[model samples]
Target: MPSDVRRTTLLTVAVLVWTLAGCRTVNRGLTEAVLDGEHARQWHIRYGSQSFYSLGDEGLAKIEFEGLIDRERVRVRYQRGMQGQAECVADVTTRLIEQVELRVGMTITTSTTIDLLRFDEPPQNFDIQLTVEPNEFPLPLFVRAGDESCTSILAQNRSYPYVLMHELVETSLAARAGGRVLPDVGYGWFGLGGSVNNYTRWFRDGLANYAGYLACEILSDEMDCPECPTRVAPLLHTSPLSRLATVRTRLFSWSQSSPSEHEREHYNAALGLFLLIEDRFGQQTIRDILADVATRETVDGRDLRAIASQVIGTDVKQFVADFEFPMIGGVLTPVTRALAANKGLNVAEGLLLEFVEPDGPADRAGLRPDDVIVAAASAPVADTIDFELALLRAGRPASIPLAIWRKDAGTIDVEFPLLYPGKD
Candidate 1:
């Protein structure tokens, strides 16, 4: 009898241990499921100052989450705030998830005084799936090229994916919507320090891959021929600023003396060559072409320039001349240094004359048009004299600094570190 009792006790203990382990596993799964659900149902919102280049005075965002619980009650809650202000609205609960979403929408307006710049498309609704009591984590979902979808992780964690997707979609869509036909042709605008910065952010959040990123980097300034389909486009290219550096010298000349109609036509022709290569060849081919060109190798018994001539039946110089057109207005101008005569440095005639020079110290320093000069060499010059003083002060050799104000954009305080001037 005692032996029978001992055996029964052992069996009961074993069963209890197994049941406890199962319960723990179920509990952990449930927690993860809940977290994911919270992430998915939340509408991740972000906005910037509507006008571009207003760095300091832009309104940040306040986040909120609204969702249904067990397919019945609606729950709305404020997730977080920025800069110590709690901008969230009063939380509300209801029986419908739709109502929860609506209520959350109402609170968004109250969070900011200025009209927030919203994404072209924001998630207005969610497709909820019902699962067992203990839910499981979902697999990674894929986004199509130029298309994006928000997941629970992005929504709940307040991840930057939503903002990044907006940029990607906006950029791709904007390029498509722009006058340019070939997608690669749009690469010129997208291949800049700014574009690369945004691209990196997008890649980190799983919005982009190697191809698009590299294309943007190589073609930032060559707006005429924007497309470049290559592994570089998807992969991060080392220098987004490469093209920008070369562009500075051309800026002053382009801006001061208008390109002759003939020259303009030539530049436009070159742009056309870019468009053709981008449209006909895949990104990999472009990469191969660039690699061959860089290494001074021959393809099919011809050098890069020669191969280009064979493929297009025209030399690089001729091809550039054919497509080149007069410099179009409204493109970004290269910046260069000008010292104030009395207070701010005067823009040197040469620097001012050049429309753009990509890497010139003046251009790299970010000077804009119609900027008033205030000081040079960190010294305040107050005497308001005639034109001679202004010109003389501008020529001073000490590394200059200037405070300038533009009409639309605000004032900028800048300094240019002088380098040994190359053969100018």
Candidate 2:
């Protein structure tokens, strides 16, 4: 919640006050400061909402750059040249944003702004700052993390695309909800506050982080969040990936309200609940849940639990309880010590299907009893843990791929349909 709260968009008034101090301001490569009076006036007119207001004269050097991705426009304003990132950062970040939009079946067409700020002295020294206004202005994107500039972050983190996507997706959803359901949340990126906006912190961050990881996974062929994904390191000891859901996602008494301390990495719980939903219903259900949030303006405001439950035709509280998510499903076994020796597998080279329930996910994927899964989701599975980890990273899919070694068929690939619990 604190990490998400760092996005508090005090950009406007903060910049105004800082610039008004009238000395030791950033003049590095900033076009605004050197513009002639008339052009400066016109320049301020165009971008004054970004806090370039009331500057009669000053010296600052900044960078102006723009790019398009998947037909959406992106603009970046910076106090220093991005060096090489200036060429590809916007395109990469915008594409990640586009992926999140496409995944949710929604598109926020508003142009986005990325601010790369560096404060060299006083009140803040050697720090990074973000500035933006989505509703008040068209720039709905801002990212702040420690003292690293956005460009610096990109250069340092290969997974920076995920960070950019997280900010954009969260802001976009906030904008859509603000524009529609919670009109009282005010305009601009600051629209993320209110009774309803309380949902913005944990749940919103979770969903955004989930969406961002998905996009990152798709682009990189793996989920590459340096600090995340490891939260799932405890390769599930639960049922098989081919199991049936014994419990359904129906609303319960406890889910009537959204809990504030609901911080089990909303990302983790959400990923579980949603993947279960995806396995049971379909991936389309995930899109439906988000779409419902964006365009929905019910009497209860934008309640995620209700919206997800409604979409999944069940409830959301099950996952919220102590941040617990069901890992219940079918079962797989590590190639037994004897079996590994018999099969010449040195280090848990594969998993054996102990029981593939008839008409279950395994059966639907053409898995049969005694089958050996050598790989899952394109990764080699050396044990039950590997297979489960693969399944976890793959999320829930109707047709996740599996490669198995059958006594009769050798190594063959199968498009496994991962169904969830409930024959319903």
Candidate 3:
């Protein structure tokens, strides 16, 4: 199969496992394991295995600036202690206001605040936090301090500007959605009554991610360079639709909740859902969905479904059901046969790989799709969680032995070099 289709298939099977597993804890761990593996592989490919460098006390000093957008004052701050980096951030923030204004079709009369900080370690990515007051017109957004300036992509670090644009887009959406005072129906897991809260949160989060995607796309286009080091490339490469498939399938069951760990899945799923809406119903449908969100005092699944159905002129539940479980005719399917077959394996058992990234560490080490990874680094890999723990225990720069099984080949072992030279 083509790489993209194979990736979709692997993601589908992983999500099905999460939805069908009887035990929530086990399922959560396995899902996390699968995701973490993918993240580590992606990070390694993008940034390589280079260690982080501290900017010292000088780099941690804060730089602050002010601007006016739509006649509303905006405050921007960062800790890079560099004139160019600060200027880049300020410029992006200004452009973001214009992009958001055009997309939301509003004047954005509210004042905004933005902060950018640096971290001392790795897991080098960016995230946003929005604080809103009841009945507030403008919202306060914090881009939680990260070592963004210290991280490099494609041999140079231009993440600060791109990340700033993303956070601003999210903040703009939140401001339009009634700021911080919007009612929270305890979305996610078994909160309040029924599944509406969970789906509502999903819709809200998905919209924000899509907004970020839109902002990034604008920036990417203006650059007019395919390798311009814009944030959109990585976001596109991360395969949000595949990740959303996992979130949609395991919504009520999966329990892992660290924002740093799970935000990508949430954002990716949200963007995917939004993109699907645009693809099927048109951009106007997306605007209508947001408009519905802005006018509602309380958001519930029924209300959301009604708004969506009204916009599409069809049963929204069926639409959602189709999106959530796209593989088996809008129904949850089990992988009991695969799980049952692993029972006889003497080594640890886990999800079998359907496709490994070409030239990846596993591929280079002779690991192939359909190989049941029973153990990692001599540790029992009964599931994804165990597999992740084993990988962690093995650490970087280690030759980890993977115990595998194939129908014709029987029990065999392959050694994967963690943090391989060039790949890292």
Candidate 4:
């Protein structure tokens, strides 16, 4: 639903705005006074869109930033209205310097709280005032909670053992960064413009991160966030990892969706690996390692087997051989074994098997037992766990495409009209 909002491309108007803004040197100087080094080098930059919502209300989307940050308490205020406009305000505290560069802009340091608002509002209503300097703009600075710089550190209070802020910050960052679809092997860097978009995969990764955060909280006593899935699952009372595996398998077996068991398994396996690395190294190591692997090939760039050998300094074949993926039906299958025998799969574990309902569309299309469905349409269906889940999540009947490995015919593509199971 969020993705459905069409982005308008007003080429002529945008071009005219840019051209007109560039033509007036005096206006440019005045505008630069705000964005340049004046006013303690603070700015309130905003971008957003206006759209009609289903309720006939104007929906507004926006983001805003302002001020130099000197303290840790970064306060941002956001208000949404039924009309096609929103307001955002921020209070930031930062050290002042004569000159500083943040990304593409040159800025000055001034300790201050900048109050800024954006809409189709008049400038006089929101114009901020400050003491003028003889040669340059003097920056206004404010400090909250007793600190003069308008960015004072909160007094330490150890009354409670729970550090919710820390957890929230960590999880928020993790979720923001997690939504990446990863390559099973080869160089780790996400490739762009090769008929595949890395950001799209990253979006999926964000979901996985959310799952991980929930898993961590629910299974904290037995297994922490950084523990390997192998080690963590064994520790949990309900075995969170096991449950995830089960859910993934079941989702795969469902009637609709994308992402095969192989793909899901690969994702879970990477998660498991991250936990393992965290357990062996440290909790912080997971992100660092992932970032490294994501930007470049592993040191060896061979395969997981090779990398595992280097990291654990042991023969990984036995461990790989022993690996099994769990199914919601309480079955365990040796994914690694199937993979080792060249099953033409991506992930070795966490596959699902979904049988078409009797007399249903898949059945009418000739799908049979042991069909080894790989994916539906464009969705990846590596195994039964995630497949089943995907199917149940599909809200309507849709055409399904599958990659099946028949014992007699090998791998082949099949299309079937898939209706909602209950409805069919």
Per-residue alpha-carbon lDDT of candidate 1 for residues 1-424, written as tens digits (9 for 90 to 100)? 6999999996687567658777677667667977878743567788744423121212222222222112122111222221111111111111111231232111110111111122333333323232212211111111222222222112221112222222232233213232111111112445552211111111111112222232233222222222212112121221122221223223112221233643333222222233334444434444444333334321221233464555444564454433211111112212223233432333321121124356565455575444444444444322211111232334435445655444455446776544442422
Question: TM-scores, in order shown?
Answer: 0.18, 0.44, 0.45, 0.25
Q: What does candidate 2 score on TM? A: 0.44
Q: How high is the lDDT of residue 288 in model 3? A: 73
Q: Which 10 successive residues of model 4 have the least lDDT summed?
A: 153-162
Question: Per-residue CA lDDT of candidate 4, range 246-363, in tens?
Answer: 3332321222133564344444443433333333454443343334434432222233234444545554444333333222222223344455366554443433234545665556
Better of 3 and 4 by TM-score: 3
Tens-digit lDDT track of model 3 for 1-424: 9999999998788677766775586577877987888743333456554453333223323233342223234554544343344445455556665875567433444444444443344334333233444222222222324323312221133443344444444444445354431223334555544322224445545555566556656655654534344444344323454455566644322222334677666655656666667666777787776676667565554566677788888875466445531111011111124454554433333446666777666676787766677767877654443454365445354577877776678878887666522234
- How accurate locally, in lDDT, is each candidate? 0.30, 0.49, 0.50, 0.33
- lDDT score of model 3? 0.50
lDDT of 4 at 11: 41
User: Residues 1-424, candidate 2, lDDT per residue (tens digit)?
Assistant: 4755555544454467568764345343233545633343333344423323221112212333343222246765543344334335566656666676777666654455544433331121122333435532222122233444434444333334555556555555556545222222323456653332333333444455566556655554333433322222222212222221222221121121345443332334434444455556776887887677667663233376677768766555554342222232346666655876776544444677778766667776778877888888899875553565576567545567888888756789998765443432
Q: Mark the regions of model 2 whose C-alpha exceeds 4 Å error after superposition.
A: 1-72, 77-85, 109-112, 115-127, 134-155, 176-203, 221-264, 298-303, 318-424
Kindly provide the TM-score of model 1 when superposed on the true structure, using C-alpha atoms: 0.18
Better-scoring candidate (TM-score), 1 or 2: 2
List the candidate 1 regions with Cα displacement exceeding 4 Å: 1-53, 57-271, 278-285, 293-314, 320-424
